[model samples]
Target: MNRKDKIALERYRKRLEFARSSGEVNAFETKAEQKARIERAKKDYAYMCKEYFPHYATSEPADCHLKAAKQTMKNPTIKKFDEMPRGFGKSVMDDILIPFWLWINDQAHYMVLVTVSKDRASELLEDLRAEFEGNPKIIHDFGEQHGHGQWEKGFFITKSGFVAKALGAGQSVRGLRVKSRRPDYIVVDDLETKELIKNPKRQDEYVKWIERDLIPTMDGDIRRFVYANNRFAPVMIQTKLQEKHPEWVVNHIKAYDPVTYKPTWHQKYHDNYYRELEKDIGTLALEAEYLQNPQVEGYYFKPEHIQYGKMPKLNQFKIIIGTWDVAYAGSATSDYNAIDVKGLHDKNFWVIDTFVKRCKMVTAVSYMCDFQKRLPKTVVVHWRFEAQFWNDEVERVIRETERQYGIKLNILKIQVPKIKKMDRILTLHPYYQNGRIFYNEKLKSHNDTQVGIAQLLSIEPNYKTNDDYPDTQQTGIALLEPYNTQNDGLNYRQGKMRPKNERI
Candidate 1:
């Protein structure tokens, strides 16, 4: 069938179904019933939205949040932010529907839509053009448009004197004007990317532009701003904007209902559907994308979010080493002496064993000696410790422990610079995100491992707790990096200096 025939059939089916459900024909409808429907549509923004764009909205909920958004946008002094998950019609609402509605109602005459790239911004404008040209519902309600000659890719001028323009981030938006009108509303959509946020300097630059350039382009104090994005990172531009200006009203719509693990909008993304996606992408990525939790905060070590499973056998490991974060006295309040037996098999970084203690120096040395003696006979375990924390007395104890244990400890004293503790722990965060870190299942039972897990989960900037486990794990991972590129399996080479130095 042709498109027109199909549309006719679909409408006929809907009408017939409605008649059967209500036990009444539309031809016999009461005047009161028709009046109520008309009055309700006039009052409801979501109702009006669907009435205008019925084809784009299927399984329409009672509330699509357009009503609330419209009310919020009515207050010009209120800067608005809506963080909706992917595929939730964020662009349709912010880039097209809200702006178009505001324009037709004479709420605003000039609007700007900014995105990550100029091409994306232009495409958003093209959507508006398509709607204006061909949307029968809009044309029937608002009359035919007379802006055909003025419509273009990046900017358009409606015959009613409403102007819409598209611009990318970092582009010059100063003194933006069309005739005597300046932008009355600005809609920023996903202006951040992983690449853009990676550099601290670049992030600051973007923020400066948003504050110094974008906001100032408005004609008066009664300008409305709408920012739409998913919660990609805690340091994202929207997050920063909210921090600087606490008055901004922010709304975050998560894809899934956290308690039920079901999709919030089941018609689009169902529970079982996203559970499969969660499995494929892993929990960390899924949480960031759908749950609106990036698992990144001030303290970067997220041990709770780290992927863990049964580790391979000791023999299967290509490299195994016990790396240390040493303390001198190990007093009750002093830093705990810590060591982690770490190994690498395939792409997985494994923490096979952990030892952390608040005891005398001799006791700490004994734990290290015992850890060396317990390793597999076939495994040539390399030993590394912070040399700055050791002295002639500690070195003498290590030599005697080797003689007594009859095990040659391939020990290396790494003189690492005094870096800030928090910075050191965060170096492992990327590996955790990539699902590369695993811990021995039994390690959870040990107090030191428990301490490590606690620190990992609760870590933040200016972390107050002892981070012995995370610090030692960092050392162990650093030692394993050299072998990460080699193909001939675990090669025992001299340990190199750690890559990043912490600020003292």
Candidate 2:
């Protein structure tokens, strides 16, 4: 016999011996009984998955998401995207359980699983082989049954004539035929990596592969596409899929609620546990993996966008002002009162310093007075605050502070505009993007500026806590509106608009 034939014969013998040793060969049950039991389980995907993967069985209602996604994949024409958060068991379900279900139910003729890398793809295939060949639950029900000579890493076949292969992202998947049948279902899991999403060009290429090459590999009209991933970036394959086909059934299950911050599954992951994760990885990373909302650097505020260098001398600018966003509640957990001190010269604006602290209303007022006293007397400081919530109380504090400090104060009480906070925040995005805003290096050590920048980059329309820092910063930027040539009505003062000469 030829060498290849000899190797194949020896491999088959080894598999048969292994199966016999593992008690996979059923001696008592008839073929009809085994077939009947599998058919019964096939009617319910959750039961079949539980029966095979008993260790993963959970009472959490979120598991229902998996079952629903499986049903979506059962159709031949329906394409699906399951962008579940990390630790949601998406990869476990897609790589192993769903494929097993399709094979046993005779719903799919051939399937291919793709992952970020060829090594990871092969590892997932190896995991599938372990369950097929050694899992006691599957073996006990189905008996010693596997395709005799078609089992290997990265490629495998079931005794029921189901063909499975594993390939890496962007790998050659065309002309993939098993037993004269083209791939009927494609399961993609974790196809994005940090490096891939960091580059827009690479992201475009990935989208092309999915649109031009990957989806067309399906053999039949009634084919299925199951794409699952944790959104490490806002621009990912799942994001692309959702944009391309809004009609597809997309299940975006976050690990926790955005408002309550409660874990979807309390038994396994609690809010406290996620807080620890947030502390370890920072807010941006936690938002990406746990919340399934990636905060791309430079999407809103980028470190590179702001020109960072030595702070200009406070007296060098024509005007210096401070903008305040006060916390009316004055509770221990309320927003900190932030006073952003800014200097404006010609067209450039420099953040001279910052005074941010969490305190009661009286103490916050005292802190602002102390900050003003420390600045040079020649540098005119104008203060503006949101007065809609507690205007009377804030005015009283301003009067009390001026009386105690014995210094005239120019304060602007802006009636907070009736617009979305994000809409106002977005107005300052251009200044950041154009390198018009400069920050003092000392702000990082003296103030919570680093944390504030992170908060700004991660801010979303529905974001809960981060609006304060960016809101204050945006107010500081708004101080330049009088100098902007675009605001024809407001630019009457031209060069450096002085604060109204009034005593608080």
- State TM-scores per candidate: 0.57, 0.64
Q: How many backbone clashes does candidate 1 have?
A: 1
Q: List runs of model 1 lying over 4 Å from the truth.
A: 1-42, 61-64, 146-148, 295-458, 462-504
Per-residue lDDT of model 2, residues 1-504, tens digit only: 999768755755554444234333356889797777687778777667555665554544366455554565557677777777877788777777777777676677787888888767866666666667767757777666466888877788877667788888888776577647888778888888777776777777777887788878886665888898776665676777688888887777777654346677675676677767766776556666777655546456666765666877777776777777787665435676776778776566788776555555666667667777887866667777776645677778878988999776677767766888888888777677556678887765543465456567766656655467778888777776565443323322222332345222
Least well predicted 10-residue stretch by lDDT in candidate 2:
487-496
* Prediction RMSDs, each to the true structure: 13.5, 9.3
Candidate 1 worst ten-residue window by lDDT: 490-499
Q: Each model's number of backbone clashes?
A: 1, 2
Q: What is the C-alpha lDDT of each candidate?
A: 0.71, 0.69
Taking all chains together, the TM-score of candidate 2 against the true structure is 0.64
